[model samples]
Target: MAGLACAGQLAAAGHRPLVLDKGRGIGGRMATRRVEIAGQACGFDHGAQYFTIRDPEFRMALSPLADAIAPWDDGGSEPRFVGRPGMSSLPKAMAEGIDLRQGVEVLALRRDGSAWLLETKGGLVMARHLVMTMPAPQAARLLGRDHPLVPRLDCVRMAPCLTLMAAFPGAAPRPFLHHSSGTDPLAWIAQDSSKPGRHAGLTCWVAQADPDWSAGHLEEAPDSLVRLMLPLLAKTIGAEPEMALHASAHRWRYARVTTPLGTPCLADEDGTLWLGGDWCLGARVEAAWQSGTALAKALTRHLHAG
Candidate 1:
């Protein structure tokens, strides 16, 4: 969300920006997965469930994706929007005709005179300006322990999350579309299939464990997590565990931003190098977008390139 938002505005200003991610697709935490279960294809929004646009500018920015997004009833006090087909749909729409390379990771970053030299598996990518949208810990890894952002990021605490994606055949018990309670080990659960444009014949559910539980079991195997989580889900949804056609687990090491930097962004003295993400503000798709937008505008002003 952060990277795409920045690149979009920068591109519109006549500057070409190249976006790269190690994942197979865009949208970062706004991720979705597809798996074949019992001869049927099922999708799960395993990452961010939905997003709320509190900023008028952010809402206006979503105009292009009005058709792909709709309100999600996540049992929240306020309404939120989710992408149709999957949560990644909105980002996939933003990336249309944009220079984005997936399945690529930056191994290291080095300062080369006035440019930032990025070392990737392919080769070195040098840029006069650089914007890093990764989590604080990952960015600190790339920059090393001596960088100024380390101590500040050390204060910005992020939590791990263990999510379960389970699918059952027709007639699976679904008492509600979504449920969340801070007291439970399974902090939140949603009938993913209840959302629009999903597989109708099957019941798909996504459950996220609380931060404490996720932290305690962060190193456990994915299959083990699934084995432990499915029964809890079955018990909660009034469904039979044996009826599940597909069950899987996804671990997010940096899932939620609990303690943020309390700033919109961080830029080098020259404004050529900027680091921003949801960690800069609060943990939300909106915060990530806001940080990236603010930093991009600052970059354009400092460099005067767009």
Candidate 2:
């Protein structure tokens, strides 16, 4: 969300900003996983379940892509919104005119005279200005501890998340749209199928473990995590584990920002390198958009001044 937001705004300002990601597709945490069960294709929003639009600019930014957005009546009062069909839809739409190169991993970062050189697996790519929109720890590691920007990231802390996606027959019990528990190992469980624009053929459920539980089993294998979380979800939803048509687990190392940097973004003395993400503010999607947008505006001013 942060990377795409920054890139989108920069592009709108008539600047060509290049976005490189190691993942094969767009939308880092706002992801959707597709699976075939009983020959029916189903999607699970295993990453970010839903997002709320409190910022006016965010609402305006999404107005142009209304077709890809939907209201998720999670019984919440604040009016939550989700990407239609899948959570990845919004990010994919936001990436429409941006120059994004996926599957390009940056191994190292170095200053080459007036520009920044990124040593990616594909080779070196140079940029007069560089923005690191990844998680704080990842950006810190890439910049090394000695880098000035790294110190600012030390105050930011993120928590991991272990999510389980399971699909069962359509007759499974629909207890609630979403359930959250602080003490339960499975902290959050939502009926992914109940959301707008989702396939109704199968009953899909997305379960996320609490931070403590997730951190404890962070190193476990995917299959092991699935085995551990499947029964818990089945019990909560009043379904049998054997009745599941498809089941999988995903681990997000830095899923939620527990302690944010309390700022919009960070930049070096030269204003050539920058760091920003959801960790800059709260964990909401709006925070990422705000951080990225703020960073882009600052960068625009700097470029114009030069």
Candidate 3:
């Protein structure tokens, strides 16, 4: 979504832009998956549950895509938007006309004279301007010591999150409620099937462990972790989960931003490369869009001056 926003703003200002992602699909953290049980399929958004809008600029940008975005009704004054059909639909909508390439992992970035060379698993993509929307640690790995902009990116930090999803046969005892553990490993739990577009018969649940717990037990077996978590979930939701139709675990290495860089975005020494992400501003969909917009504006001014 951030890359698409940046590309949109740049294209509107008459500059060409391209977006590359290592995953098979767009929407970095706003992810969704299709799990089948007894020939029935369910769509679940296990990565980011919901997003809040705090910036007017981002709200303005999202107005056009409002039809695709909807209110989440999470007991907040500000409305949270989800993709109309699924979570990934919004990012796909933003990337409509842009040059987006998936399954391309960027390996290293180096200066090739006046231009920059982006080496990836596929091949080298050359561009006069580059915008990296990846997390700080992943970006630092690709940057190495060639880019002077690395040090400026120190303010960004991401925590880990372990998400566990399970499916049961019968209806849950009560409606979904967010659960927090005072000092336990689990931080939050939600009922996935309770959300929109879920199967009526199947009960779905999502559990996210706190940062400290996730870090400590990062290497634990999936079954063991699930066994340890089911009781807590049962206690919180007031029902014991039955047949485990769709059970899986997802580990988010860069789950959420702890402290933002405070800057809207970052640019290279030569003013030809830019960096933007949720961590650059705040960790949310709106912040991601804001960072991208800010980077696009900065790039526009830099290109015009040159």
For model 3, residues 39-118, the per-residue Cα lDDT tens digits are 77877777887777777777788788876677766565767667755677788888888888999988877888988898
Q: Model 3 clash pairs?
A: none
lDDT of 1 by residue, 1-306 (tens): 888888888888788999888889778999989898888887899999888999999999999788778787756698888888899888889888789999889999999898899988988888988999999999889989998767777888899999999998875554546456666799888888887778898889999999999999999999999989999999988878888889999999999999999998888766677888999999999999999898778887876743
Kindly give the stretch of ten consecutive residues in candidate 3 with the minimal lDDT sum: 234-243
Q: Estimate each model's TM-score.
A: 0.95, 0.98, 0.92
205-239: candidate 2 lDDT, tens digit per residue: 99999999999999999999999999999898888
Worst 10 residues of 1 by lDDT: 171-180
Residue 215 in candidate 3 has what lDDT? Answer: 84
Query: Residue 246 error for model 1, in Å?
Result: 0.3
lDDT agreement with native, every candidate: 0.88, 0.92, 0.79
Number of clashing residue pairs, candidate 2: 0
Task: Report residue 189 deviation for candidate 3 (angstroms).
Answer: 1.3
TM-score for candidate 3 = 0.92
Best by TM-score: 2
